[model samples]
Target: MDIIDENFSQDFHCLVYDNAPTHLKRTPTAPSAKKMTKNTPPVGKNWLVEVNMYDENGKQIYNSDGSYKKQHVQMSSSGFTEDGTPQSFYFEPGHEREGVFKGMAIILEERGFKGCVGRNGRLAECGDFSQGCVTAGQPDCCCRRMLYNEPDFVNVWPRLEEVANARGFAVLFLPKFHCELNFIEQCWGYAKRVYRTFPLTKKEDEMEKNIITALDSVPLETMRRCDVLDSRFRSL
Candidate 1:
């Protein structure tokens, strides 16, 4: 971001990344119904999402033994409803179970989706949680499925995008399993080929030097050609 501001301040920038798991990961507290209970908890109990604790500096907190310190926090709001009212995952203040998770059934009920949990309604989830509804085109087959397909739920942005948008930049994730569309992969392949030609060395320092030299050996022309090929593929 600093480099972009320093060199290309006048132009809009949108960083493109491949659909790697790390790149697609959302913040731990991001709104999600994957683990939410079907109904509200028992009296004196509450449901919360477990997330890694972070210090004031935004760094993850760790225990003395190096394990991450975990804390339970309410998931963020599930975005606004069609009427533009903010939808919170937990019940509002002054309610019987104030601040407790509303559960999938209640959450859906507020969205005007009724009969999602009782005998006449769908189950908490279909037989295959991953496959969702028993048949395609049956989004209301289950409570969880209904919530999963909700517009707000489906449109939750990844953490990377949130960070980039905060800095006045946009982010786009390339299609998954399409290496030909990501020119950087070709650059890495070129670097590996160059590395293979260097003298074999088991020493850590020499290996590091060879790797740096290999990466630097990728020509500007080769990078441009790879990018052009990717652009052509995208157009197709």
Candidate 2:
């Protein structure tokens, strides 16, 4: 937008391609850890178990002199807290039940975000998310799937479009799940491969040097090649 405003008179278009969670301004609130009770069996999914070794006398084992000896026993799915509630419970009704998506939607609506075009190609206006939406598959319920499909023009996108429009430019979004057409993905993969080639080291300074070296090693020709390849694929 800035470059076009400064150098060109004709309107320009900004095309954005995104798929990963990194692009979302705010992520969905994570579920509270499942607590384990005496009667409740161990959990299995998404839980880690940590055990501390103690001597026969029931006291925590210590190192030879003063340091405490600590070792990771194994990863377990056992319930963490006694109750289902979070250990440090900050009960945010919206975030707890519906997740951060509702909170994000509320914030956006408050800031004049009217919501985005849905898969049906209609503007899905913001609703009262303080009370969570109904689950999908029910009669007209705004379930998790629907919420995900809702248009999001709150953060980076709205700002980008606003700036571009003010400078006589149009902002376009690439089709969803079309990463193969994005040349940047190939460049990122190439960069990661280069980064992996660096010699493994423990020193922080050495690691930083290796990272910089790997990034700087990607030639401009390689970037051009990636873009050309992407164009060819798109044409095909």
Candidate 3:
């Protein structure tokens, strides 16, 4: 071709690219539809859901006390009692789970987060979490066909297959270290900063609610950020 290939790097290119994201060459999943089905509207083939919880008081410290004796402190269990109830059941010297699991579960259920595939995914269970936990640990994939308990141990790809039923998202999981994919992470970070700005001595429930409110204040860059309509008119 007699055209300059450097046009892609020109200011004009940047302006065009900035205004609209490059359209995808292909749809990775689903079949083409000529008409809208009663159950199926124009939407993404997958659905996305994510849940995360944080507790600043859930800190831990370890120190060597004597020649070989090491001491460990579970700051989470030692926080306080607001409703006349303890945070966690202390077992051994260095073991404490504080309200971690329960707190996380509540957040997930409250937000209506279901098991689906994305990066670092966990299996979604119908009712009893035993199956979900098993899938989360082993995950139904070619690699590691067995089952386990920890989600970190399983390959999240299998979870992606399980998530196929959801509508409203792509097959890919949340992007790592990417601010655009999961805006909630930034919201949480911002909320944490805002909450820690002033010294606080509030009830546990109140504190949690305050942080959630702060997180909700973030505004999404919708026009440039949300997924655009697919160009179905182009026959491919």
Span of ten consecutive residues with least summed lDDT in model 3? 13-22
What tens digits encode model 1's per-residue C-alpha lDDT throughout 1-236?
88998999899997879998999999878867788888888888899988898899999999999999999888887666546688888889999888998888878877788786556666887886686566645778788888888877788899999999999998878999999899999999999999999989899999999999999999999999998899789778
Candidate 2 TM-score to native: 0.37
What's the lDDT for all of these models? Answer: 0.85, 0.46, 0.32
The model with the greater lDDT, 1 or 3, is 1
What local lDDT score does residue 52 receive in model 2, on the 0 to 100 scale?
52
User: What TM-score quantifies how close candidate 1 is to the native fold?
Assistant: 0.85
lDDT by residue for model 3 over 1-236, one digit each (tens)? 01323443232211111111222222222211111111211232312112122247744433355232233222222222234443331223453432222222222222244332233443223233434435444333211121222232222233233333242223333323444444344455666777776457568887877777666654565322332211121111
Best candidate (score: lDDT): 1
Candidate 1: stretches off by over 4 Å: 80-84, 117-121, 128-130, 135-137, 196-206
**TM-score of candidate 3 versus the correct structure, residues matched by position:** 0.24
Point out where model 2 deviates above 4 Å: 3-13, 19-159, 234-236
Q: What order do candidates take by lDDT, descending?
A: 1, 2, 3
Cα error, residue 113 of model 2, in Å, equals: 26
